[model samples]
Target: MKARILFVCLGNICRSPMAEAVMRHQVEQAGLNDRIEIDSAGTGDWHLGHPPHEGTRKLLDEHQISYQGMKARLVAESDFETFDYIVCMDTKNLRDVRELLKNAGTLESRAKVFTFMELLPDKGIADVPDPYYDGNFPFVYELVNSGCRELLKRVQADLKLA
Candidate 1:
């Protein structure tokens, strides 16, 4: 069966959506699109039905990455059971997801959750910083892009789907 992955963030407008797009591109480039299902959601419903943040869309466009046909969705109760992996962008998101899945019962066992950067050798720096509150769009883009590349490698290695 195809492995299902979900990326989570505060509002699904910046970090999580960016990671989702980056990972989708990587998986398709590796010709594993059929073997992997990628999606993104927010811990809160603040951005529901909203498009990704403009800066994020622009960054992806600058990289020739298409993030069209995507919409923000809330992380549903069923997501705990549906996704094989629930990757959060930051520690706050991790806590939020943990709370959401706290009473999900056995779904907890099958749900593998972590910050996207946790797959890297660096442990403490895994949380993707929220750039919406700052003017450092370029730096945030670079950090997220680099982390996404590392995350792709880990995903490939872990699933042996490389």
Candidate 2:
């Protein structure tokens, strides 16, 4: 059975989408794409149906990461039940996701939720800083790339992928 991962954040504009795309790429490169399903969403519905933030799209373009055909979606209540792991961008997102899952009854035992940063303590970066409101796209790009790389390592280790 494939392990499903859902990335979450306040808005689906910046951090979450970036992490989603990068992690998807890493999983594909590692040949785990067939056994792992990756997707992303937001705690709120603010950007639902929208493409990722322009800066985010641009960064992906620069990296030659194919993020086309992706649309932002609100994290549904069923997501907690559907996903094997729910990864949030930061502590605030983690708290909100926890609250959401707690209220969703069946999700109470269906998912393991965590902040993406928690998987990579050795990097010393606690979170992927949101750069949507700010003009610094490069910083957000680098943060997501770093986090995704570390996350790929952890996921591979967890799955014991050779």
Would you list the C-alpha lDDT of every candidate in the order shown? 0.82, 0.82
Worst 10 residues of 2 by lDDT: 102-111
Candidate 1 structure quality by residue, lDDT tens digits, 1-162:
678889999999988888888888878888888877889999888889999999999898988887998899999878887888888888899888888787555436376888776765454575677877885667667766777777677667778866
In model 2, where do residues sit more than 4 Å from their true spots? 123-125
Clashes of each: 0, 0
TM-score of each predicted structure versus truth: 0.90, 0.90
What lDDT does candidate 2 reach at residue 107?
46
